[model samples]
Target: MAKDQTTRICCIGAGYVGTCTSAVLAYKNPSVRITVVDTSEAKIGAWRSRSFPISEPCLQEILKQVVERLAFSTDIEAAINAADLIFICVDTPTVTKGTGEGFALDTSAVVACVAKIVEVSTSDKIIVPCGTADQLRKLITQKNTKGLNFEVLSNPEFLAEGTAIHDLLHPDRVIIGAENTPKGSNAAARLVSLYQAWIPSDRIKTTNTWSSELGKLAANAMLAQRISSINSLTAICESVGADIQDISQIVGLDHRIGPHMLQASIGFGGSCFEKDIRCLVYLAESLGFRHIARYWMADLEMNDFQKASQTERITSLLGPLASSKLTIAVLGFSFKAGTTDVRSTPVLTIVRDLVGRGHKVKIFDPKAKKEDIQETLCKANLGRERAIVSLNAMQACDGAHVIAIATAWDEFRTRPGLRRMDWKSIADGMQQPRLMFDGCNVVDAKYLEGLGMKVLELGRKQAML
Candidate 1:
């Protein structure tokens, strides 16, 4: 591939991963003609617009710089035919039913994309499995392409939602998993060259196909496991009156453990962590490693328990749910701060549990749009209009008996105005003896108690009257 020549790169999916990856690639390598293809026209349209669909700070400016180089279309065949390197970035969600329902990845779309690639591409082009490699290998083997020649490479992306652009721009490391074959190694090298524009060559790591695939899953599992471990300790901290934050900070200061993803909150939530962990567990079980599977499964079970424990705390503080028709204010809905993604938000789990017991919920998040929250709630088979989406933090708190801070958005923590906003204004706006449940441990329980409001903070004992 010529350095100055326009290297055509086509990404199969236009979702979060596909869009962000394509944008960054275009931004980094202006010479590369990056075309992002998706089945959804709305998604493509959003990408074409100025106010891009996703709200990541500095993403719009970056997109603007490379808008000319980047193209969005629903025409996959045209994009694939003209592309020198094709990235299969479609969703490989967990299978719901069948033999490998819970654990195995559903690769129907990946297969379809591969078939399309085989049909269209004339030259021996590199086909990179941007998705997980293990699942793609199964599909490749099943198809049995004895005649056609193609280079398959595994180049997994490790970008979080909120900080995807930052991660992509300043990646810690770029993993390229290729076969020992010349063609496979060459393809991996080609992909590495693309990232060499921004990322250091030394940061680029190479490994076998299986190792790369399992590495992605293992990385996420371990990140989530750390969170679950901290949360599990939060329970003991609450019982023993120990400060979870202080404990986390002190433990994180050690060079071995390090301080990252240690901040205690409701639980871990995102598209990757839980799904990947479950996939890892399933893979282990299939390989006759039952003990390994059980150990991994325990991490997820602990996560669920942590979310459920919050609901239990709410009921314990607020008294019986049968007689009290309490109005609950949810501070945040998105899985995490800085992004509007609610893939597997612990807030949903908490809301479902509360609603199941007949409590009304009112939600508010600065970044999360109304439609996104509504769609998430609808898909979860929860009420749509039952929860009112507020414009500001104070508005959401108004007219609510209890305030549950689920997502630890920056505004939830350091905003002086949020703290100063009279709980009396909230109380007068609602029923008497207002309750506040700090699910994220962002609020100061002492301050709230001084305001004469019943405050229950996670990883701490309830405030005494």
Candidate 2:
């Protein structure tokens, strides 16, 4: 199967999925030369320089051992020409406009990648489809391009951004989807061999193409549904004086339901969960299954509601929001901690709303790069005069009339880091009736209340507050 003297591997994208996945492959198989090529020279340079292009743990350590085997470049055609196996790890962002608009997947990059490969290829290469594509269109590309034969195998990545390295090294399961034909099966076997370097044989699953294709979307959809379901219960908890954390603990005890993605927060935000769920909804609607589409779309709708409502909810808590000339402190800017990725970060919606209402928002995130946050703020046309990033945790919360915990960074839980004073100091340094809004429901509200502060937390027993 992949019995070439030296297996050549090329990954077509150097973004989140590409960089992490290709590094793991290179680390596992030292003999196999892996080339990671991206359109962005800056991204390629970042990868080559062995810096954190994306926030992933253990990346530097792994790259140390396999950096020589792995190469990053902007040359796509040359990579395609020399590769026996190519992983199309390009991005498939959710379409934001046009016919499908908000829900459908924008696979323009994947389509364009296929066309380029067809134009350059001289031999049949094992094309492992890690993201998205239709087989019929692939067949058309095959038919049109002379001397271009691509063995398209579906091998989607299931690694989370924060824990990508660990997930790659010790994956719970590995799925390899291929056509039912002999060539497809053989291609799948080659991939299985590559992964078998580290992953247990039992963990690798072989399936038909369609099952593999939908499996990625379905898995993400199910995760989003779980998160939305918990968020939905949060509203009830808030009104009825119940604690979502407590509810989560009680419900999580059920072995069947499991205890993943059950935490109630502002909402789930990342590259995958929301967008992938939208894709599932779009697919259902395209097939005229309107009922099924609505059923699936509900999860995404709940997530959006949770994010959008944060600003208004906080405004309602503080009467005459703008008239009050509120000084707000926001801790955690990234969608989740341990990563600099801020794409679709729920905090964006809240920050925008607050700035629009004339509230001054001071932000602090130990991990989220200030430049990235600034870029996002620039896109939203949020002037630095209103929303600005503070140097440290304490600085952001110093003179704030209200403190909002947006991201669940480890540092947010403690005090001295934020002169968010000791219960004793809080009263003296902070304004009267110091209001704290726990946007993520991550902080200890009861403890904050003990400091003579008025704490409003999400999905918690706050009716009396």
Candidate 3:
């Protein structure tokens, strides 16, 4: 295929990674015709409508512009037959049973997709896997026989949730892994050319097949490790009465250390970090490196501790949440800002614990859908009177004794150093001793005090922080 030639691309899974990646490809490259196929008819229907399956900012707007170029369908076989390239962006979740339970990646989805491809596809096509599961390569090799030719390429995504569009437009780096042979080089170049339309040539990195798979796991593990390291220090700072902000500044000033992903909060929560780190641990253990596996495993343990400790700290502050009968609110429910994905969110654990403690809870998010929020909490009463989903920030904090700013959303904070709340209204809505817990440090404590709310931040005992 030539550099400027139009290509038919079929993405097997239409999820957070698949949908965003395919949307960007279609928008940036008019030469590229993209079809996203998912097994769930409901998801395909949502994608076809103005309302997206995922609540992402500007997603529906962009979908409207690129609707002609992009197609969402449940017809997997037909989409596959018309494609020159197949992108497998299926979910590789943590294994729950059988061999390597809890740490190994479940590659059954990708394997099943490959089987479907073998049954329908008559021509050879380049298959690029975004998930780094080991079983994919073996399945491809075993399935490859007479009258069948498929090339496996690894192209893992490092896209963050909130800034997905921007990241795709100007990626920090693009990784493509193929064999070092001539055929592999040509296949890799085809993908590089597609990205070269928007990304700089130098930013795209090419490697051998195995290196690419290992690199994907290493990248997520390192990011999770940074969060765990900073969180571990936050505990020390809290006990010593030293501010976490001071520690972060002084420690981050180092030229080698730098300042990125070092923000100390409740913990790191998303689809990738914890799952990928545990995958790394499993890989190490399978290789017989027991010590190495345990070393990296501590990060996940520390993250879980951070969430539990945060809940404990808040319950202790209220003292008998059941008898107090307070209406508490959480500002954000999604794993992070900008996307409506609730997988592995720290706020869910906190919310479940609060409900168990007999505290009335309310919630609101700028972009999160009501369905996703309810699913994560696993409570139907949340939509009812038990813990209502508020319309806005003001409504969420209207009748709560304590407000928890769980996710770091821009609207919840005092922007441009300006207060945006009715102090008297907030004060009158709640019972005695109105408290605010700043989980993500988005709210300004002193500024909230001016608005007639007592703010308590994590990792800081006094107002000095």
Instruction: Estimate every model's Cα lDDT from 0 to 1.
Output: 0.81, 0.81, 0.80
Off by over 4 Å in 3: 1-6, 132-134, 319-323, 379-387, 415-420, 463-465
TM-score of 3: 0.92
Q: What TM-score does each of the candidates earn?
A: 0.94, 0.93, 0.92
Clashes of each: 0, 1, 0
Our tally of clashes for model 1 stands at: 0
The TM-score measured for candidate 1 stands at 0.94
lDDT of 1 by residue, 1-465 (tens): 553343999999988788888889898897889899988898888887764777886788788888788999999889987888888888888899997898887877887888778767666567886565555555656664655556678878888888889999999998889888886777787888888998889999988888888888899899999999899998899888998888899999999999998888898888889889989998999999999999999999999999888988778766554357777889899999888987788899888887887778888887888888888889888875566667887788777777888998867663466653455466567555578778788777666666667777778766443
Cα deviation at 21, candidate 2, in Å, is: 0.8
Q: Which is the better candidate, 2 or 3, if ranked by TM-score?
A: 2
Candidate 1 minimal-lDDT segment of 10 residues: 414-423
> What order do candidates take by lDDT, descending?
1, 2, 3
Global lDDT of model 2: 0.81
- 1-465, model 3: which lDDT tens digit per residue? 443343999999988889988998998888779999999998888888755666655566677778889999999999998888899988889999999899998988888988788778878778887555346667767776646667778898888887887788889899999978776788888888889888999999999877888898899999888888888877677677887877878888998999888788888888899988989999999999999999999989999999888877776766655366678888898887676777888887788777777777898887787767777666434335566677887788886888888888776776555445555576678765688888887766776788677777877774321
